[model samples]
Target: MMLIPTEKRLDADTPPEKRGQMRDGVRLLTYWSDSGRIVHGGFFQLAHQLEAGDVLVFNNSRTIPAELKTVDGIRVRLSREVEDGTWDGLILGESSKKLEFMHGLKALVTGPGTEPPLVRLVFSCSSSRLLRELYRQGDVIRYEHVARSWPLQDYQTVYASIPGSVEMPSAGRAFTWRMLAHLQKHGIRLAFVTLHAGLSYYGDDKWPNPALHPEAFSIEDEQAAIINDAKANGGRVIAVGTTVVRALETASDGNTIIPQAGVTSLYLSRTSKLTAVDGLLTGFHEQEASHIDLLQTFAGEEGVKAIYKEAVAKRYLWHEFGDMNLLMRQERS
Candidate 1:
């Protein structure tokens, strides 16, 4: 078993704090996957491993400019919500305190809301200038967790575009342009789809449950044609992130995939039958979160357990910037 560095092994002797630290954040587990075979390695070998006729698909949806700032002793954060408005919600403060000084409005933001519809904030503030100021600083934003301030880019993927994702789709971060070039040189092709990530609420301990978050998307016809052509020609179709998998699968009609544009609250797990994606490139998902179950479906239960056990034993890192896995398709029944 290869132990990922970020994990704390719990074989009936782990401590509570260590277990809390260990739960599902295992990283750095690498493996070679074909229809009927699996091999272990460090993650740095992927670029030199793949061959021609393999198509890698990526999600270009960007993370939103969101930050949790304090104003007048009130905790708040920015987010894009629904029904035509941006929500600058209040995260901390007495629920019945009726926030003082907010001129018939809330000036503090919490729980991240919609981008534009007249921001509803707490406290008495003149405008939403603070939120705009954070955006001006090269898209750097922060969020408070328990007591730590996690950097916004830390929650972002390298290919992030569209400034509306409160959180980030993390799988593509480890991929560099060099990796892309390596694949191209080896005759591997690439395609992209857009599935703007939802806010951090899905992972926040306050919610702790996979929020029924809705996602916005825009896919081009050329992208669909590229995917279809690859599949028809018997090339491998690799979904670069779980976000891409959800977007492509949701848009698929089992045998046919059509270009789609809209918002969907699609929740995926192992029981969810896949439609278009034949393989997946993804990061480690937190325990019990929806992504884990979804990945389990592709990895196969025993395969996933073995891979994770090996990764944890190998001392892999955890979280968004952690390592990745390649779950290949089962070519034969």
Candidate 2:
């Protein structure tokens, strides 16, 4: 895996608050795994690249204001919700004293979390109220790469409805309602699944552990039926993001998708067989990130490196507020 060049990184770049107007402003890089062909175009041209009957699976889980600034100057990013009003969160800015939050919320540091900056937080309120006050007091988490603070609405997709994910399912953020209508006019079908994305790649420099963190997801019967019919009819099932791939693959029974609603700890790698997805549309990820491994499972390692190198040379951006990549096979699997 190669590191993203400093200049090509999407440093401080964020799309405008209005998304539908910028459909033509975003960039897209498409790769055909079977034929080794690459096509670059504007994001608005996405509908023209695919034929009718393609099923694009999207993650509908919305982003939550998971970042809370404690009165003690601690920055707490709530990652995963747990039982008994507890949450797995990351605490930045060290404070030897117990932290106090807004809306009468108190944070009792239970223990170390799964990774660095992560810590277990036991809130003073009940489970339900704890969740409600989170929205009342917290702001959307920000990264060092971003220049300024943005609202939670800026992190949401047009189709986002369910509120659960700590972070945005950002690959789907490039989509607009108008673009979706265009896709529908071209006979491209859409399906929605819910995968509450957990902790994101912060400053961690190491590859993600194979033991994935549990993330909640839900696939309705209609969604499963749509995906199954698409596969059975020789239509491609294109996952809108890696989260959808994880949820769909986790709910797959052999080659067929099953309606399921639960938490998943599935990790896709070179060794894993992808039975549910035939194509992937996702944001440009760091080369050393775990997502590149999933990309290797879809495309080959060498091919991924080549395309990434091309993207870097062409000045395509990396990270959440970045360009998009569409990896599809020329032939059906």
Candidate 3:
């Protein structure tokens, strides 16, 4: 759906910087797919909407400090891990300028990756050394919406432990220890899957070509068993973000999920039938984002347009540190 020019945008269009307290003050917009019913409330009430037996699958992959400023003044953001000594990186500020690295490290721009803006950078060091140097010098990637640099803690979830993703699994960012305790205390089971998210925003017109974009994902046997058990028992399996949906659906064998680890090229659209995810908890996406298409899969085209319109009208904050929307499937028992 096209965005109305008069409508307000996210931190990009509005004043740059996060508003209010972290996680505690986030708004939750719930949409019931069966009836097209919408409910608005604070995220603190998430437990009230989900049943006790429901399983909320989260992407536990943590955000890496991927944004780096080279000595030559070129800005580099590593998008994906190509091999032990290579990465798919995006270069900004200078295209023709040569990159300079320390400790005998060297990066050569091979060619474009999945997106036009992304270029492959073959490095000289091993993965371990590259990661150490990255953590030492790089900061979290930011967009035009954020006016200043925020720490990595601001981009991580309360339960994030695996460090790999180039960007935050933003939907889970709204969950804090307090909120997690509440959900656990109320008997809502929480499970985790890992999808090391790559650079999502490339300052390009659309997302990376779905057929060409391959993201690494891992779903453990234990997590898969929990999800399958939940479904067998008539409990809903709600994915915390589009990443989780991608991971789960990619690993699914018929209606049962197989514990596996690999690169997933699966892309969800309005016509794709979801076999694993029954509901979704995700941040409000920009109008042009391909993520809207995934949202359109759960909530119909009209339903998504309505929900997005309400979110904009409500003046909900947008982006990584923005409000969340929960789309619940009507088929849930």
- By lDDT, the candidates rank as 3, 2, 1
Q: Select the stronger candidate by TM-score from 1 and 3.
A: 3
C-alpha TM-score for every candidate: 0.73, 0.93, 0.94
Candidate 2 C-alpha lDDT tens digits along 1-333: 664565666542576444444733578999888877888999889986787888999999989888888987678888887766787787777775377987678978878766655677888887678768878988887666777787788888989999889889988988889889989999999999999888775455643453647788999999889989988987899999999989999999888999988888888886688888888998886565567888987778876877787787787866677788999866443
lDDT of 1 by residue, 190-240 (tens): 888887665444223433223345677767899888888887877777888
- Among the numbered candidates, top lDDT falls to 3
Candidate 2 or 1, higher lDDT? 2
Candidates in descending TM-score order: 3, 2, 1
Total clashing residue pairs per candidate?
Answer: 39, 0, 0
Off by over 4 Å in 3: 10-22, 96-98, 102-104, 204-206, 331-333
Give the TM-score comparing model 2 with the true structure, all chains together: 0.93
Which digits, one per residue and each the tens of the lDDT, describe model 3 over residues 168-256? 98889888888888998998888999999998877855557665778999999899999999888988899999899999999987689
